[model samples]
Target chain A: MTILFEIKKNYELQKVTWKEKDILVNTDCGVKQIRIWKDRALLDWHVRWRDEVGKNSLAVADRMIRTSEGKPWVDMGSEYLTLHDYVEGTHERSGHEKRWGLLIGNMLQAGLELQEEFSSVTKEDHYSFDACLAAIHKLSKEYNELVSVKNSLPEANKRLNLAMELKKASSHVPLPLFDSDTHMNNGGQIFNILFYRGSDDYPEHGYQPLRRLLTEWLKECGPYSLRKLLTCINEHFSLEREQGYLLLAEILTPWELQDCVVQLKNEELAHIVSYVKSFEQDWDFNRILLHCFTDWMDDKRKRVAL
Target chain B: MSHSNETVNYGPILFQYDLYPEKIEEVGKVKKVISRRGTFALKETSLNEEEASWFTHVIHRLSEIGYHQIVPLYPTKYGDYTVQYGNRTYYLMPWFAGGDRFGLTREEAIIEEIGKIHFLTLKEQDFSPEVVDHSFQYLMQRWESRQLEMERFAEESERMPYMSPFELTYLSHFHHMMRMAEDAKRRLKDWYDACHSEKRYRSVLCHGKLSRNHLLYSHHGEPHLLNFEKAVLDTPVRDLAVFFRKAVHLSNWTKEEGGRLLSLYQRHIPLLDEEKSLLVSYISYPEPLFHSVDLYRHQRERYSQIEFVHRLEKRISAMRHIRDFCDLILTPPPPQPLDTNINTDHI
Candidate 1:
């Protein structure tokens, strides 16, 4: 039987059609999006977090539609399938800036709520600044023949040193338990950060997504936009105390620069110049990001003291 | 049944089940929802978190224990038996279309089902003197206090220079009602003593609010019980008393009918002597009379004088029937009076 036939059999929807990647079906209740998942454990976590958050009228989260037998997902030979109510609004940042900021905060808070349960099921990646710096140093030496890369090595070390200072200063601060996917990035011309409902595809616990959000906002929209986002998040849930120090420490660290340098190692000898040049551009971008974040933290600290 | 645009009001609740109600009909407290998927009964209740969990547990447990006579609760698309919106909790179930409810009245079927459930879940609790004493004393104190309140009301009414029709009606039956209350207390004492002697008590999952209205029949006349909101673990006598008391007020009820109903229930689980005495005491208690007087005293403005009197009189009539049933069941037929002429020869 065809995939549509399989879905029809399981979901009992009469009219189903593909809209790009999502399978849109006109259900008796309303239009719904039928999506498939490759990972069962991930899907289980999604279902639990969504169910918990969706129970509250104040918080908005995606809810999975159960099959006739009340199972949240159907097992095909290779994949699992689930259904959801089709949301029509654009996630693009609109005039509702404050609303977007509040939503992001609330969604993160919901993530924090599931920290205990999520931590037990999945292991989170630990970030080691020393290991990252060591890798970058090794990569710069190996690619010393490339002029552009050799020229940027000192600036990279200087940035790493500053990040080390910040880390040492904030070493006493505690990291929050919740970590999930930063759903929006500034890579595109339009920032898609204002979705009305929370996504179910959040990452597992033990890592903080707030740091990623800060880094992305700083890179894509500059320091001003990042400051506004932090302000909005503080309005919803206070992250200005210990959480602030943690985010600043992580941001000041040169994880992205290390990643850029590592990627430079994979280029062909002939293409090495172009790759090095690109790496140099990214390095410069990250340096500006660090200064902007440091300045924001200093300003915040002074205001809090006052 | 009244139909209107109330469908929108319950849209969020029904939407949880992936149902869009095309038509909504009010059937007493339940909303009869007709949707493209099928017809369903959506009951909205005010249940707290704990009570909602217990209600769902009871329903699921009954099904787990192979009892298929209950109306099964349908889970939402998100897989919750109950969906909480605002302050109200909602649950959905198949409508179970009205069937040929001819053979067995709802009351009789309810009693039989109650008995089957009691038989299935009945447990003989370990003897605890403190529990027995506490339960007995608590009930005795409550009954005595209520009786005293009724006595005060009676005295107050008797002192009135001119009595209203309701006052006169209540005054006339007050003495007899008090006597029956005292008799119920005596029977309760007997039950307590029997429990002490037996060194044990039995508890079942009692349908705490037993009435005919809580039961329904399927198309093939299979009884489907619903409304287990007040279900709890208590003496088996609790359900029997609730059912018999409510059943007596029905127009077609008689002493024989009540006896036959009890017998039908007894087929599944025979009532122990103490349990039987407890049932008798519960059923014979004239709490309804006291409730009527309380209503008259506090909320008489809500109803006409004639209405209060009519309600009081109806309860009095039902109490008389209950009295007869209790008397016949509790007091063995007095030893046949000696035929003086024939007995002497036999002696």
Candidate 2:
């Protein structure tokens, strides 16, 4: 007998047909499935939502087929089977950077509307930057002991070192963060918001989705992609000048200073020596990072950056 | 928080390619320099000599194997992929297209491509007895401790008049959790026994992570796999388990659909009974629960009481679905052995 026999019996459906597309092993659940659903209800939603993205509104609700009565989401489990219409098509990964930028802009705009509409919806209080620093402080001892024999230069070591320094650097300088509710601080105080394209489990360190997307566009799309993305952002959203500074900090400093050295050709580096020079306490580690890559940064272009 | 002291000039850099740039613009961390040669994107990063060489080999090998989607890293006129400017290394490549998975046809195509990649990268490694033992020991210790922790939590929950939200959620789903946990332990032990007895396993270049995020589909609808940053030599099942885990995430797909997809993979590179069993065991572990436990323990100071509890509750719901799927996978029909003889390298 098919697994759906039970679900059909329980749901009292006129007719339910589904194809099990894929199976996954999950830590939360031992086994799960990727399914394509065909029932009266989802068929309606799918038919309607086929043109939603083309309609210039990312109204996800149209595509979001509701679950069966009493169920939370489309159930891939054998026992209580339900489904949301599966998005089975392929999205082109490259080209049309301006288009993608516009698309993302639309999404962010839609997200902002949704966020406001669901303002009363309970927010999940996630870890804050203050807490992130504290967590890194607690884990620093473990990182030192866990150094393995990697065949390459361990970027992990550098990340850990930078993360630790970030604790001190961020204390005095407030970072403009993304307003992603998924990745939040202790008090639910969000500074900036940006859409992340990766896994829900992992959020990038800083909230510079625009910067990240711009890099992707430059490398994978066309030269005008960043301009398009910025244009989309400008048309769809608003920002403060300080947020622009945060965006620059999140971006310009590539892991290696030399990557940007050529770009830094003719500029007077901001003298941050004065800022730290006045601070008697808490400025020790921030001072160290400023000196780490001074050789690569010409003396004329020497300036303090957080 | 301060601006860079250096003003970025792309003119001198563009001269390295003997191309006069019409315009040079900052695009995120990289520079978009347009010259008569066409638009080239350059990024500077820190990488050791070995690392760069390995990446070059991997990308080139894939291209050589007819997977040209491994965006060619254009060598400098000096024939170097990386150009050292100060302490940084920069490499430029032709801009390739990127796309996401959409309808069913594309999904099938992407899966088929993965199967092909796995087949091409397949290697027979001598089944290391030490590796098996180490993995088994780690599994046993971790699961055993987790079982203990759950039990302790259960005991405390029973004693308290008012349970924490997480405790309440756990208790509500307690039976499902315990049953699945026990089954996971048993399945792993069975796999360990099979490994010890069979003493034959094949290794393939595992993508480590094969989410839709890494896949790039061109306008012509060809699939391109990206990012070998965390590539590892492991059993083909390592990749399969990851793919499977993600495939079913919040999906309405069934085991039949999953089985069909696996069959597609098997058509390219078959899996042995041992491998299948290992994959099942691998998927059954409550990794999400442990992740939640870690978050709860380490960052309780950061997240509110409701936040953590709600998170756990949501996870518990997902776990229930996983339980059903794992039960089906781990059940009695043994996997058939592949006909072709795959002799792995004796490491």
Best by the lDDT measure: 1
Write candidate 2's Cα lDDT for B250-269 as tens digits.
46657766676777887898
Q: What is the Cα-based lDDT of residue A242 in candidate 1?
A: 59
TM-score of chain A as modeled in candidate 2: 0.38
Writing each residue's lDDT as its tens digit, candidate 2 over A1-306 gives 354443344333334444443322121111123234434343332223222222221211112222334332344443223322222223343433344444444444443434333333222222233333343344334333212212112332454355445444544433322223221111110011111222112112243444544444444444444444454454444322333334434443322222122222232334223322322121222223333222223321343342
Every candidate's lDDT = 0.73, 0.50
Would you list the clashing residue pairs of candidate 1? none
Report how far residue B101 has shifted in candidate 2, in Å: 7.9
TM per candidate = 0.72, 0.44
For each candidate, report its DockQ versus the true two-chain complex: 0.23, 0.01
Instruction: Compose the digit string of candidate 1's lDDT tens values, residues B78-166.
Output: 77898876678889989988688767777778988998899888899998989999999999999999999988988888899998899
Per-structure clash totals for the candidates: 0, 46
Q: What is the lDDT of candidate 1?
A: 0.73
Candidate 2 residues lying further than 4 Å off, grouped into runs, are A1-306, B1-52, B76-78, B82-93, B98-107, B145-163, B301-310, B327-347
